[model samples]
Structure formats: structure tokens, C-alpha cells
Target: PAGRFGAKTGGRAGSKPGRPGAAPGARSGGQGGRPKPPGAKAFGRERFGQDLGPVRAPKPKRAGRPADEIDVHNPEGVRLQKIMALAGVASRRVCEEMILDGRVEVDGNIVTELGVRVDPEQVAIHVDGIRLQLNEHLKYYVFNKPRGVVSTMEDPEGRRCISDFLKNKDKSERLFHVGRLDAETEGLLLLTNDGELTNRLTHPSYEVPKTYLVQVRGPMAQGVGAQMKEGIELEDGLAQVDSFKLVDSTPGHILVEVVLHSGRNRVVRRLFDAVGHPVERLVRTQVGPIRIGDQRQGSIRVLGRQEVGHLLASVGL
Candidate 1:
């Protein structure tokens, strides 16, 4: 009756030399042991040749050290708020609001704490259950926009949109115009996903240099270039050109290259027009280290890494 330890069915009901079923109040050989934990299996259930069948449940979620708790593993990591901002999903100021609203999470757990440092690329970050892809390729573009299309991302007036050009081109990432060009104006426009760089360059206090070609309707007085370089008083205040040169001059028409660091609302046109020579056409030719560079109208080109670095350095970024 006590012959076999673990005997299969189709055998004698009592314990025997070849087979034996468990006696009442007795346990199977390994049945009394702990139940198989999640994600523990042997070879899994094999199906067809190619189909390996379902996988075991994943191991329990890992609980790592806090992001901003100063762990040696995350030396270069920053707070989650800063990390999210760096990813270009939103600005730091806006991210703080989202965090407080309980819309932000780390590793699928709601993280309401501020000053949490996170390595954006490595950390599992989510906003309202949508996992964010943080390491997407950063893109920088210089567009030579022609007249007619609206400078903004979209226009409610149903006018042609410049963003349409990038609609199908970039799907995973978002691009924003670094600085806006007026609907009538045409020329170089910097585009990028780096919010910090964009905000810095666009801020008036940075005083990044920009150049434009202005076409006046009538001939100017003698020493007009000097007059522009010295500055002209507008209704707002005095405005000066960093440099002005006569590209061409003739009766009823004149072309001049004007450079300035302080950009205002159509200041170039207003300044020339203030001098009794209202500009008939104005095209911005350059900004910081970027130039129009033979880029045709409505064309987008990715700026080279070296060019991006040069521009950043020029602005002391």
C-alpha cells in the first residue's frame, strides 16, 4: 500500500508497487508546495511550429529609487518636470500645472510631487495614461517661405498654411516656427522642437541679429543709408539699423540691405516708410547664423548639426 510515492491514474486505487493514488488527507508530491508565482513557467505552452503560445505574466513591477532623491545611478537625471519640459511636450511652467492636476505619472503611478529628477529617455513617463516617447529625433529646419501663406501654424481664415508642408513629412514629432515672418514678408525662418532654444532666440532681450532687404517706392535723400544707420524716430521711438547698404537705386524704386538686432513689429518697413520711402517689399534675408542660402520659396531644409551649434553659440546659448 506504501510502495509508490507519486502514481498516475489508470492504476490501482490503493498504493502499489507500480502505481498509487494519494490516500485521503494526503497531498500530491509537489501539490502542497507554493502555487507557481506569476511569470514562472517551463517552456510555456507550445503551439504550432511558429506560434510559441502565450507568455507568462510579467514579473512584478520594479520599484526604483526616487528620481530626485540623489541616487548614484541617476547622476545626470533631472526632475520629472524639467525632464518633461526638455522633451518639448510642454514648458516647465505649464508642466507644473499638469503635475499638480494629477495628470503626470512615473512608472504608471501618479506622481504629484514636485522637484522629482528623472532621466527622460530612460524613465517610463506618462501623461494621463499615454506613454510619452521622449527620445524622438530632434529636428531643426530652416524654411524659405514665399508670400501668401500664413506664418502661423494654422489660420482660421482658411488661407494657405505653411505647416501643411510638414504634415506628412514629420509624423512622430512636432515642429514650431522659431520666429514668425509676416504674411507679406518672405525669407529665412528657423524651425525647431527645442523649446528652450526657441524661447531664448525669440525673447527680445536676447537681441539676436536679423537682416532684411527692403525695397522702397521712391528714391531716398542723399546719405539715407547713414540716416538709417544712425536711426530714425518712429511714432513708437527711435530705431536704428545695424548696417544699411544700397543694393540698388533708381527712380521710383530703391533696394537696400538693412541689418538690425532689435526686431519690432514690421520695424524695417516702418523705419524706411518713416523716411518718406515706404517699403513696397520686405524680405528677411538672415537671422543669427542662418541665411536664406539659396533656399527657394516654400522649401524646407534640415539645418546641419554644425549650423545649429554655430547659431546657438552665436546667441551665447
Candidate 2:
């Protein structure tokens, strides 16, 4: 490498045969008998006021942009709980409990670590070798709950519920309802393991807007919407409807659209009862950033990403 440094040689390959000038490599001889070294301590480089070939450096590595930076194809983005939930195993919280209980294993090793990150597609996560993380593609399903089905995952008495309705549903992953609905109500229900969004929507602190369409046993009247809007006192204290408008009405029945920030159990029914018009049938027509929009009962549809983003933005999630 030192010899390859062109600074030692003249512009030509070798030194002149018999000249007073310096040789190519050795810079002729010392000052006592010949020209001094071009850059020796004894004779400074400015002594001749000339520059030789540069210190060769293998072309300086071309001085270009970097390679092997971020690998976009890396598959280590999914959280462990999410992976298990999406594998049709259980809910995220249940998955965490299993992991902590030492029931789940990843790569044949029982991984009890919480919040572990792994490649869902590449790594095999198993609970008793039952293969988790197989269907973990961040799935979402909206179910139109019918009456008589409990809104939760399971019941203590084992009554016929929504979970039964979803028994033969798309076996993509272990999904659960976003919020809850009373057994006598029929309405929109979202199911997914997107815990962050679920927390925002379900937590009463969020006060997310929920829209309900109620068929009440009453006559169409001008003051009914006003009475519902002015607020009414229930066992849970006073609750107010964000908006209440008459949809269609008859002498014995009235269909009214009611929007509220409360997801209380039987909230729509209770609100109507507080106004002296107990609801005969309560059906949720819309949820925060979601709606039925002609979706039939017991049917399911995947929510779009933009819809999810809008929901997040709506609640400042």
C-alpha cells in the first residue's frame, strides 16, 4: 500500500538515469549529495513549492450514498399479544394473561415475556403447538348484533348470545366486540383486537358519539325531541342527547334518531324512559365514525383503514 502511493514516484514510472533531480521513489539522495526528500522533516514540502501525486486512497470509495440502511421488508413489526389474538386464539388481554401464565410459546421456546415483538409471518408462535400468529394481518370485523345475544364474549349462565352467532363466522382471528349492547337491543357492533382504538372507543372517558334509532310507543309530537334534548335524570344521573330528531312516526309508534355520548347499558332505552316514552325497540344505527348504512342484521364487513383513521381522529386517539 505504501508503494502504491503515487506520491513516492514521479509523474513517470521510474527515476532518470543520471540527473541532479530527485529519483522517483527515494527522492534522489540527501541534501549533502542530491535533492532532499520532497516532504522530509529536514526539508519541508514548500522547499520546492511543488506538489507530487496525491496520497492514493483507492479512489476514496466513490463517495456515494449509503447502502443497507433500513430494511423495509423486515417482518418484526407485530406485537406478541396482537399476534396471538389475530391467530383465533383469544383476546389481546387474554393473550397477555396466557403469556404471563407461561402458556404461550414462540419458536418452540416458552416465551413468558410481555409485549415481545416478532415477525408474525416468519416466526411460529404456539400455545401448546397450536400455531398462533398465522392470521395476524391486523383484521377487523363489524357485526350487526341481533336481539337476545349478549354483547360480551361469554356469559356465566351460558345463555345464547352473540358469540354463538359468530361461532361459524370468519375464523380469521379471535375477535371481540368494541363496545357492548344489551340483549334486547339490535344494532351496530365492532369487533377487533386493535386495542388502542378499542380502549378509546369503549372507555366512557372518551364520550364518543353514539347514534341510535329508537321505535318508541308514542305519538308524533313537537316537544318530544326537545324534551329528550333538554336532558333527563336517570338512576345514573342526568344524561342528555346530543341530537334528537323525528324520523317517521305514527299514532301509536314513533321512530326517532338519537345521538348521545353515553354507551351506558340500555342507555337509549333508559333515555327514552326518562322522557316518559319508554322505547319499544332500540336499534343502534351508527357508532362513532361507523354506521350500518344498509348492512343487514348478523352480517359482517371489514372496516377500511381510512375509516379507522377517521375514528381515531374523532376521539383524538
Candidate 3:
């Protein structure tokens, strides 16, 4: 290892001892000619102008829009839970539970408190990490169906359906009937896309009330209302009216008002027919707080906010 770095091997014949650059062996293997293979030396701070330290991965791009990008200053808004309920995510009470469980979010921030208010028109909302589409223009309509028109949006046989009346409405929201009525029955049918409200109105657990006006024929049976209230056995199951009354009567026809919570198909007609009377005409008069009022046949109108409010209140939504 004596001349490992091309140090002079003492003065050679006619050689400049201190100047290894002048040696042929040094030119071939030492610093005089061939480079030290560049990075053969250990790295040092002087290698570069500045200390970059250790390389790191780039900061991850933010997951979503930043909080500052959201308008926290929205002045007019409704309770966050109520907004979720209206969005059909859940009932307001259940939405509160979801919030408390950190499953609800507004503008990317998990909101656990029930008191948070949100301008749904301005803010983004989410539930269980999925973005929620808040229908700012929530729609509720009551259609006064006419006889011979189906209660559905379409019929394969070209029979007139409820869409005939709603197709020309100003709004374009897709609507569904809360429950079905046969082609011969009509009136006070609800059309809405409010899923939570619809569920409560139609679900058996809620027992939301429904009222019907029926025209029947045949001799009046004694204590018919009382007998019907006690329940009658039908092909599907037992059916009964919550309340029934004879509104008016002629020699051969009688008008009766019946209220019940069952959503059984054709239950009213079957109930009356079982008691010696057959229904000639049927019209739904009310569903919960909604009524046909004087709404003309084949007409439709958006429900008022107060009416919607009353309906939600009745169902604890």
C-alpha cells in the first residue's frame, strides 16, 4: 500500500520525484490522467451547494375541497338533520343519531352535533362517506285522479295513466304515487319523490291514516258501520276501517266515508261487498294531512309548505 494514491516511489532515474503527474505509470492509474471514477469518494456536504436532507414523498393532494373553500358564512339555512331527512337519507331523529355517530358530514367535515345548520343550496353534504344529493327543490303534489285513468305513470295497454295530467307540469321532477288506486277508483292521490315522507306515509309501522268516499248500492244493512269497524275477513287477510259513517243515502244508493290505515289492495271495495253492498264508485279523500279539497278531477297542484310540514310532523320526521 506504499504508493496507493500515486505517491512518488522516491526519485526514479531522471524523474521529478515530487511531481507524479510527470510519471507515465501515474498518468495511467492516478489523479494525473484517469479520473478517480467520480463518486469513488464518500459523499460530503461540499458535493452540492445546499443540503436537501432526505427525499420524501410529495404531500398527498388533499382528499377533497378544503374547508376554506366552503362558504361557512351562509346566513340562511335549515337544521342539518332536517335537511338529511328531506333528502330522504333518514328521519330527522335518525339523522341526528347518524350525526352523533360521526356518519354525517357537511362540506367534508364530520358533524356530530344536531344544531348545525346548512344552506343545502350552497354546501355539500355526505352520509357514510357518500355524497348526498339534496334536492333543493323538494316537490310534493296531490293529484285528483279521474275514473278510468290508472294510478301509475304508464300502462302497457295504452289506457290513460296519471302521467297524462302531470306531463305538462312546470317542474320535471320524477314522481311516484304513495299507493295505488284501481282504474275505477280516483281522487287525492299523492305524487312525490320524497322517499322518507313517502315511506312513513305508506309503511305499516307508521299507520298513517287514509280517508275514502264510497258510493254503494243495495239495501242498508243494520249497524253496518259498527260491523265493519270490528273487522272483516278477506281473501288476503282481515280488513277493517278505523272509522266509517253514512254521509248520505237515497232510495237505492248510499254515500259512505271510511277511514283506515291499511294499504291492502281493493280492501275497501272487498269490505263493502262482503257486507251485502257493492261499491259503485270510490274516491280517496285524504292521506294523513293531505286532502283533495275542491281540487278538480284530473288536476294536480304542488303541496304547500305548511301542508308538508304538517305531514312530516304527523310522522315524527
Point out where model 2 deviates above 4 Å. 1-136, 167-172
Tell how far residue 48 is off in model 3, in angstroms.
94
Cα TM-score per model: 0.57, 0.56, 0.60
lDDT per residue as tens, model 2, 1-317: 12353454333423235345544434333232444445434222222324443343343222322222222213346777787777557799898778777787666767666646777667656675444325445566678888888887768988866567664544446676888888888889988876776888888888888888889887755687787788888898887899988889787898888899987777788777766788788888888878888988877788764465456556663
Reference-based TM-score, model 1: 0.57
Candidate 2 lDDT score at position 25: 39
User: What range of 10 consecutive residues in model 3 has the weakest lDDT sum?
Assistant: 42-51
Candidate 3 off by > 4 Å: 1-135, 169-171
Off by over 4 Å in 1: 1-136
Q: Pick the candidate with the highest lDDT.
A: 3
lDDT-based ranking, best first? 3, 1, 2
The Cα error of candidate 3 at residue 70, in Å, is 20
For residue 286, give model 1's deviation from the true position in Å.
0.7
Residue 248: error of model 1 in Å?
A: 1.9
Model 2 — which ten-residue stretch has the worst lDDT?
64-73
Error of 3 at 93 (Å): 28
Q: Please give the distance, in angstroms, between residue 22's alpha carbon in candidate 3 and its true position after superposition.
A: 99
lDDT measured at residue 258 in model 3 versus the true structure, 0 to 100: 98
